[model samples]
Target: MAYPQHTTTGMTTHPDLTEMRERLERTASSSGAIAVEGLILLTGVYTAISPWAVQFSSQTNITVSNLIAGVTTALIGLGLALAPERMFRLAWAIVPLGFWLVVSPWVVTPTHGARPGIVWSNCLAGGVTALLGLIAMGLTVRVARQSPR
Candidate 1:
C-alpha cells in the first residue's frame, strides 16, 4: 500500500475558520455592537481624563494609574472595533481592568487617602467599564455559538 504525501506552501485555508470569521464580522457589525464599541471608546477617554476633570490630579499616583488604565482601555476598545474576531478573545480582560480601576483609589493612594471625588469617579468609571466588558463578553459568546460545527 502506498501512502499519499501531503505538502504545504503555508497557504492553507480551513472552512471552519472562514465561517467563524464571517460570524464574527456579522456580530461585530451589528448596530448594537457598534454602539457598544463606541461607548467603550468613550468610557476609556473619560477614564483617562477623569483625574483632571474630577480635580484629583493632585494625587500623582492615582493620576498616573488612571492615565495608564485609560490608555489601555481605549486601546482595547480600538482593537475590538478594528478587529473584533481577534480582540473579542480579550473581552474578559476588561472586567479585571474595570475592577482594578474601582479599587485603585484605595490601593494606589492608600497613604494619601482617597477623597470623595476620587472614589466616586473611579467607582462610576469602573462600573461602566465592567458593564461594557460584560456586554462584550456576551457578544463574543453569541458569535461563538452562532454556527457551531
Candidate 2:
C-alpha cells in the first residue's frame, strides 16, 4: 500500500471557512451594526455608573448588584463590538440580564424601598439594554441566514 503525497507542508484551508470569515467581517463592518454595537457599549457604561449617578449607592445590596451586572454587560458589549463573529451568539444573554436589572431594584432592596431615581435609572437602562439585545439578535439571525451553508 502506498501513502498519498501531501501537496503542501501546511494544513489545508477549507473554502467554506474563508467565505464564512469574509461574511462575518462584512456583517461586523456594516454601518447599522456598528451603531448598535456603540449604543450597547454606551448603555453598559451608563448602567455601571448609574448607582452613583442616581445617588443610590447607599443601598449596598443593590449597589453591588448593579456593579456586577453593569460590568458584565459592558464586557459583553465590548466583546460584541470587537469580535462579532464570536460574540454575536451571546447576544440573547443580554435580554435576561436587562430583565434582571429592571427587577433588581425592588428585589434587591429591602421592603421594596428603591428610590425613584434608582427605579427610573434601572428601568430605563434595562429597557434600552433589552432593546439593544433584541436588535443584536436580529442582526445575528439575519447574517446567519444570509451566509451560505
Candidate 3:
C-alpha cells in the first residue's frame, strides 16, 4: 500500500519536508501579524477605558490610574503599529498584562466597595482583552522565531 502525503498550511507533502516547512513558516508569519496586531489593539482599548474609571470607580486614584493606563495603552498601540517585532520582543511587554487580571476581580465587587462598573465592566473587558493580548504575544513570539532573516 502507498502512503498518502500531508498537505496543509499552503504547503505540499515532501520527502525532506523542506517545502512543507517553508509554507508553515510563511503561514505562521502571516498569523503573527494578526496576533501582534490584536495584542496592540487590546492594550489600546484598555488604555482608553482607563480614563473613564471615574464612572465605574469611586477610588481617589482612579483618575491617576486611568491616566497611566491610557498612556500605557497608547504606547502599546504605537509600538504594535510601528514595529510589532520589537514590541513583541520587549522584555517588559507582559508587565501591564497583570493589570487586567488584577482588575477583573474588582469589577465583580459590589458598589459598597467604591465603584459602579469598576467591579464588573472592566473585569469583563479587561479579561477578554488580556486573553487576546496573551494569544497575540504567543503568536508573535512563534512568528518571530520562524521568520527568516
Cα RMSD to native, each candidate?
3.3, 4.1, 11.3
Tens-place lDDT digits, model 1, residues 40-65 = 88889999999899998989999999
lDDT of 1: 0.89
lDDT of 2 by residue, 1-149 (tens): 99998787353476577777678778877998889888888888899898899888888898898888888888988998898888988989988889998999888986868888999999999999999999999988887788495
Return the number of clashes found in candidate 3. Answer: 4
lDDT (Cα atoms) of all candidates against the true structure: 0.89, 0.87, 0.53
Q: How many clashing pairs per prediction, in order?
A: 0, 0, 4
Give the runs in model 2 whose Cα sits over 4 Å from its true position.
Answer: 1-15, 110-112, 147-149
- Per-candidate TM-scores read 0.89, 0.85, 0.55
Mark the regions of model 1 whose C-alpha exceeds 4 Å error after superposition.
1-12
- Candidate 1: TM-score? 0.89
Locate the minimum summed-lDDT window of 10 residues in model 3: 105-114
User: Per-residue lDDT tens digits of candidate 3, residues 39-81?
Assistant: 6566556645654643644454544554455456557656665
**lDDT score, residue 63, model 3?**
45
Model 3: lDDT equals 0.53
Top candidate (lDDT)? 1
> Considering TM-score, which of the candidate structures 1 and 2 is the better prediction for this target?
1
